[model samples]
Target: MRLPIITFGMALAFCAVHLFVGRLRWLDRTPRSRWLSFAGGVAVGYVFLHILPELGAHASTFEDATGLDAPLAEGLVYTLSLVGLALFYGLERALALSRGERMAREGRDRPHHPVFWLHIAASALLVALIAYLLNHREDPSAAGLALYFAAMVLHFVTADFGTRADHPEIYDARGRWVLAAATLGGWALGLLVELPELAIGCLFAFVGGGIVLLVLKEELPEDRKSFFLPFLGGALLYAALVLGETYLAAA
Candidate 1:
């Protein structure tokens, strides 16, 4: 039980990277694009290799338990994913539209967009959900905890860069703190209660879908500028590592 408390420290440290890493001169000089691509690769790889399989099994079980036909359950899962994608991308579109309106009305640029804050709020919820899942997992071994921390911390850093880049000041000032609080909030919830298997499966689908849309939309900018080698390298490498670990654990 006491070991779980370290998760709070881990959450703080994870959030701290968002808060302070921008201030480092060396990081400033580094080519951020490739790093972000690799980190995104790592995250996307983890989802496909690890989380998706679990989500699939859970989804199947959920359908069985609920007495829903396979097709219906599958369709609903797909729709949930599409809904998640639409929400985030739709928010981006709304932001663009709002920007156009502001420019026409004011005859100049607006420094900030409201949609960015919405994204921040949405992302905070995601962070919390993820933290809750991590803390409430069936096994809480040292090795498992470490690996989960390593993977998720990178995922958070990469996913967060997109948000911070969009509105550095806003994300840095208030968004970071909000996310930190959300992490602790999730942890507290995990300590207090557990979600039913059905709810877990649904949350997994929602978040997985959101992550797929979020990472791709953020990584793929206009002009198609990206590092494919690093991207593939990160994905393949992480996939191999995760698979190897899973096999060893099973054996």
Candidate 2:
């Protein structure tokens, strides 16, 4: 299904990006730092592409059932609809964060390199390609996927900016919780109104919940939150859920 294709492509892309980052020689400089940076890229990719989408879909279904009029695109609505309503205004606050934005704002606070921006542009292109592939068929379920993409984009932006500004060296468990809540809470709200797919929603929610717990592993003193952990966990969860769904469909 779409999940497998998305997962494989993401994994491939993750590896490629890491390889590129490894060549930086300045940012990574050390072997351990290089590995960590690569790991972070992989984790970010998996979360944005996989786990977030599933959560968004579930939320969309829930909203449709409960008749909350959360703005379903195709009997599939998104928790993002709620966020988009806020995002429009939230940007007005002007956090003076976001490295990309900061670069533009400072007019001269530019980093002594182009590798980061190059990587970003490359990532945007990759995401565009992935979106093109995934954006076919405006069915209810597909609509859910679309919403997931939007929500994940926002989550990624927030997490990227937050972690980068507040704790460049350490991971932010607080931000992770917020991300989880935003994603899960959105789905839960959607589900409240959309019960037709309750069973399916429950299945998705179970997987989503697993993702949250797995992410919490980062909070553990011993676990130390590798970038790979979130990605690997999300990929495994998605792969397992997709397989299970396929088996059931076949049966």
Candidate 3:
């Protein structure tokens, strides 16, 4: 599908960004939190990849279908995808800054941090609801759910590049190198295992990589509360645009 191309590109972008640049140290969270984040991602994959498309197929409404469309379906999908993107971005940024603050404090929790767990949980549920639609009845070639799962997992793993280190709160150049290695390694592995899915897998990594770049340059201290709103806003903007494009194309 045409949307797969965009999805593929975005997924690749996520990986490439991390492969070359490395993750910012400030963004990593607790190991438990990270696992939870990954779980949340899996849930998201389950929904978007497995369930959402089914709902979209029966939507009979522009808003409902956009979320389902692989490339462009309805306005709501546009909104949720972008919002989800923004929330993910915001969490990444928050983790980075929190790490920096922790380092400055010499390993103390930051007061008044954003509610990341809630965000992750919410994201997981949303994805789960969507994934449920992809019952075990869908065709093989139309296997978009698997692709979605790949994208989400890769994104989650790539995001680790930013936080991986002796201490996520502390900055280190070596972390970037490691991230770069992971990115390339991931691609290589993708090639060896499933050459066909390789393209889409790499695309997922690319999007993660882009996110690393966007927040990598900003010092941890500078990316505080103010960054949250803008990040969400950007996601919303992308969703709106996606919706508009979908409508125009469908018309």
Cα-based TM-score, every candidate = 0.85, 0.27, 0.32
Overall lDDT per candidate, in order of appearance:
0.70, 0.38, 0.38
lDDT of 3 at 169: 32
Question: Best candidate per lDDT, number?
Answer: 1
- Kindly give the stretch of ten consecutive residues in candidate 1 with the minimal lDDT sum: 23-32
Report the lDDT tens digits of candidate 2 across residue range 1-251.
Answer: 24535534433333333223223344322222333334334334445555567556666667766765545532332333334323322332222234456568775432322333332332233233333323221233533453345333433433233223323322233323333333333333333433246445543444343333322322222433344454355445545544554465568
Candidate 2 global Cα RMSD:
15.1
**Model 2: residues >4 Å from true position, as ranges?**
1-113, 137-233
Q: Give candidate 2's whole-model lDDT.
A: 0.38
TM-score of 3: 0.32
Top-scoring candidate (TM-score): 1
> Taking the tens digit of each residue's C-alpha lDDT, what string does model 3 give over 70-150?
444334333444454565667556665765777588765432234433333333332322222222223333334444434
The alpha-carbon deviation from the true structure for residue 45 of candidate 2, after best TM-score superposition, in angstroms, is 11
Cα error, residue 35 of model 3, in Å, equals 20
Residue 92, candidate 1: alpha-carbon lDDT: 66
Residue-wise lDDT of candidate 1 within 1-251, one digit each (tens)? 32566877776767676576556444332345677677777877877875666666665766887889887877776667668777777766666676577778886433245677787778877788877876665444555566667778778776676566556777778877888788778777777778887776777677767777777775577543667777788788888877677677888
